[model samples]
Target: MAETQRFHDRVALQLDDDGVAQLRLSRPDKMNAIDAGMFAGLVAAAEALQAMRGLHAVVLHGEGRAFCAGLDMASFGRMSEGGGVANGLNDLLERTHGLANQPQQVAWAWRELQVPVIAAVHGVAFGGGLQIALGADVRYLAADARMSVMEMHWGLVPDMAGIPLMRELLRSDVARELVFSARIVDAEEACRIGLGTRLCADPLAEALALARGVAGRNPDAVRGAKRLLNQAADGDAASLLMAESVEQAKLIGSANQREAVLAVMEKRAARFQD
Candidate 1:
C-alpha cells in the first residue's frame, strides 16, 4: 500500500495494494467546489501521480455530497470585481502544461496520465466539475447524479478542457445544445448522451472494482492500450494502425505477457510484475 498524501488540503491520494490509486476531492464542507486552492491541489495531485511507480489505474471521486460544484462562488465574485476577469482570462490563456493552461491542466493532466483513470460521480457535477470528470477515461455515475454544461449559467464558457473532451464524447449538435441551454441532465440522459459509461447505485464501489480488474492485467499491456486509445482520439488511421503494431511488439514477449499466457493455461491467476 502506498501512503496517503494530501494536496493543499483539497485533494487526497491513496494507493491500494492492487496498484489502484484513489484520488478524492476532499472539501466536503464546500461540496468540493473548485477554488484557487482546489485548482492547485488538483494539478499537484496529478503531477504526483504521474511520478508514481507501479501505478495501474486511478479512481477519481469526491469526499462530499457532490463530485464537485463547479467554480466556487467566491471565484465568480472575484471575476466580477475590477480587472479580475481580464487577469483571469489572461492567466488561462498562458500555456502552462503543454496545450493546456493552468485551469485546463487541472483536468487535462488526468488524461495525460499513462494509466487508466475512472471517475465515480454522484450528486451534482456542474460546469467545471463535469469537465473534470470528463477528463477521465471512463465515468461511472450514480443513478441520482446530475450533470450539466453549466458555464453558460455563469456567463462563462466551459474552458477547463471541457470543449475538447465534450467533443469526443458527444455529438456536435448535442454538445451545442447542452452548452447553449446549460441544462442539468440526469444520469440516464448523461449515459445516453455519452457523458457516462454506466449508472450504478454505488459508483465508487463499481469504479474500485473496475480499477482492481484493470490492475490485475499486465501493466505494460494495459498502459500500452491506454496510450493507443488516447492517440486514436486524434491520430490518423495509418498512425493508429502503426501504433497498434508498436504496442503489440512491446508486449508480445514481455515477461508479464508471458505470465498472463501461462496463468490462463494453468487455470490460475496471473502474477504480473509492474
Candidate 2:
C-alpha cells in the first residue's frame, strides 16, 4: 500500500519536506499498546521508510498519555489459557523476519533502518513498549516518563528484542537487575543508567528538532555514518575500517556532497532530493 498519514488504524507516518519522518503509535485509546494491528503498523512503517529515498531521520513518538503499555491485555488473556503468545505472533521459536520473529520486528525494525530513528518517549514505555523505544538510534525521554523490562512480571522474557537492545545500552549487571526484578525506572535514573539518550521537559519537541537538524545535513553522509555505527559493536576493527572506506567512497564528490560544500561557502541551506 502507498504511504498515508495513517495506516493500519494504529500508526501514523508523515515525512516532511525536511526528510524527517514522524512515526507515531496512534492507538491512544489503548495507551498505544501493541496489538495485532499495531504490530503490522510498525512493520509496515519501517518497510515504507526503507523504500523512501532521501529520508534522513525519523522521530518516533506515541500519540496519547503513554508511549505504549506493551502487549494488549487480550494477548495476556490468551497466555492465561495455557498457550504461548500465538495470536498473529505464531510460534515463538520461528524466525519470521531474518534474525527476528514478527513480534521482535516491531522493535527491531527501527534499529534495522539505515537512517537514524530518534524515539521521543513520554508517559510510560513498559515491556514491549520500552523495547520499541530502545530500537531507536537515540531516545529522548520526558522527565516524567517511566520504563521497565516488564515481561518478567508476566512470566515471560523480554521477547521483543528488548533484552538484546538493552545489552547494547545498559551494563550487564544493571540489565540483569532490571530484567529479573521487572523494576520501573524513571527518566532521570534511566538517563543515568544509559537507557535514555537524553532527558528533557518535552521529548517529542526535542526529538523533532534534533531530527530536523540531522535532516539539514547531507543525507548521504548522515546515512553513511549511521550504517557505519550500526556495525561498530559487532564488526572487527579491520572490517569496520574497510566498511567506513566503502561508505565514504560512495559519498565523496556526489551531488549532495558538492552541494553541502557550496552551501557552507555560500551560507545557505543545501537543497536535497527526496
Candidate 3:
C-alpha cells in the first residue's frame, strides 16, 4: 500500500503499485453523507486522480457500512437559513467547474476520468450519493444495499448530474418514477433496472479484484476503449466508425499491444508499462 492521501479530511485516496487506486469516502460515522466538506473533498479527489499518471483503474467505496446516505441534515439546515447558499457561493445555477457546479462536480468528475472507475456500493445510496455511483463505469452492489432518488423528500430535485447519468442507464419511465416518487430500491431491483451493474457478497473486494484485472491489461487500450465508449452515445455513426479506426490504428502495432500478444502466447501475465 502506498501513502494514503486525505482530501479535506473527508476522502481517503490510496494508490497501489499496480496502477489501481482506492478512493474511500472516509466519514463512516455519518454513513458517509455529503456535507459541504464532503462535496469539496470529492471534487478534490477526482482532480487528484485525473492528474495521476499511469493510473489505470479506480475503486470507489465508503469506509463503513453504507456507501452514502444522502445530503447531510446540516446542509439542508443551512439551505433553509440561506436560501441555497453554499460555502459563500453565488447560486446553484452558477457554473463553478466547467459545465458543473460543485455538487455536480462530485459525480461528473468521475465520468470524465480517463480510466475506468468502479463503485462498490453497500447499505444505502441516496440522492447525491446515487449520482456518484452512477458516475462510475461499473457498479458492484451488495445484496443488502438500498438505493433511492431521494431529493423529492427534501423538496429538491436531482441536480447533482443524476438525471443525465440515470438516463444513460435506465428507461425513461423508470427514471421518471424513481425521481418523482423517491422510492427505496433494493439491490436486486436496482440491478434489474440497470441501476447496478452486478451484485456481490463483498462489494469492495469484488470491485478491487476487478479493478486489478483492468489494471493488468494494456493501459493505453483500456483508455482508448473508454474514450470511444464515452463518445459513442452522442456521436454520429460515420464519426464513431472513423474514430474506432483511428484509435485502433494508434494501438495495433504499439509496444503494449505487442507485449500483450506475446504474454498471451507464452501463458504469462502481461507487465504493462503504463
Candidate 4:
C-alpha cells in the first residue's frame, strides 16, 4: 500500500501503508487555532477521507504547544465588530458547507465515517477544539492535557455541536457543571468525568498504535463493530437492536466478511475489499 499525502499547507494529511490516515492541524504559530484556512483544510481532509479506498482508521491531532487554543482571535475580533458570537457561527453555518451542515458536520463527519476515528489530544483543547475531539470514536489525551468548555466565558453556549456529543459521554448534571463552569481540567479529571478514553504519556503515538491494531484486524468486523457501537452510543433501545441486525445483514454474505471467517478458520490474514 503506497501512502498518499494531501498537503493543504495548513492541515497535513497522510495515509500510511496499514490503512491508517493521520490528519494534523498545522498552524502551530498560533497554537493551531481555528481560522478560515484551518476550517477549509479540515473540510477538505474529511472529503479526502470519504473518497479514499480501504480506509481503516484515522487519527486527528494538532501540531503545536496546544491541541488548539480554540477559535482564532481574528474570529473573535470579527464577532465583536459584528452582532455577536452566535452571529459569527451563524454566518459560517450558512456559507460553508454542503447540505450535510458545516459546523456540526465538521466534527460529526468523523463519526459518520465507516471506520473508527481516534483523536490524540494534548495541551489545551478548548471550546471548538474540544468539541472536535469529542466527535472522535475514541480520545487519547496526554496526562497533562488541559481541556475546558470555554464558550461560556465568552458569553456563548457551545454551538459547534459539542452539546450533543458531550451529552452521550457525560451525565446531564455533570455535563452542565463542566459547560457552565468553563474551568480547565487535567487529563485524569477528564477520564474521571468520562471525557477521555485513556490518559496516555504520548497521545499521538498511542492513537496511531490503536489505529494500526484495528487496521490489522478483519476490516469488515472492525467496521461493523464501529457501526454497532456508534449506533449504540446514540441509538434508542429499538434502534440499538435494529442497528445490530442491519449491520449484520450487510456483513452476512459480503465477500470480505466471508473471507474474514475463512481466514480465521485457516489461520491466515484476510484479504479485504478496497
TM-scores for all predictions? 0.83, 0.83, 0.83, 0.79
Pairs of residues at least 3 apart in sequence or in different chains that clash in candidate 1 = none
TM-score of 3: 0.83
Candidate 4, 86-192: lDDT as tens digits: 22343333424432345555676787788899999999899878988898999999977888988655545565557667878999998899988988889999988
Residue pairs in clash, model 3:
none
Residues 48-124, candidate 2: write the lDDT tens digits: 89899878899999998999999887765555443344354565555667666777788878878988999999999
- Going through the candidates in order, what is the number of backbone clashes in each? 0, 0, 0, 0
Q: What is the per-residue lDDT of model 3 for residues 1-274, given as tens digits with 9 covering 90 to 100?
A: 9999999999999999999999999999999998878998999999999999879999999889899998886665544443334344445555677666777789878878999999999999998899899889999999989999987655456767777677779999999999889899999999999999989999999999999999989988999998887786433433322332334334433555455545544568877678
Model 1, position 167: C-alpha lDDT score: 70
What C-alpha lDDT, on a 0 to 100 scale, does residue 149 get in candidate 3? 96
Between prediction 2 and prediction 3, which has the larger TM-score? 3
Candidate 4 residue spans exceeding 4 A from truth: 1-8, 83-100, 235-274
Ranking by lDDT: 3, 1, 2, 4
Q: After superposition, how far is residue 62 of candidate 1 from its true place, in Å?
A: 0.4
Comparing 2 with 3 on lDDT, the higher-scoring candidate is 3
Clashes of 3: 0
Q: In candidate 2, which residue ranges exceed 4 Å CA deviation?
A: 1-4, 234-274
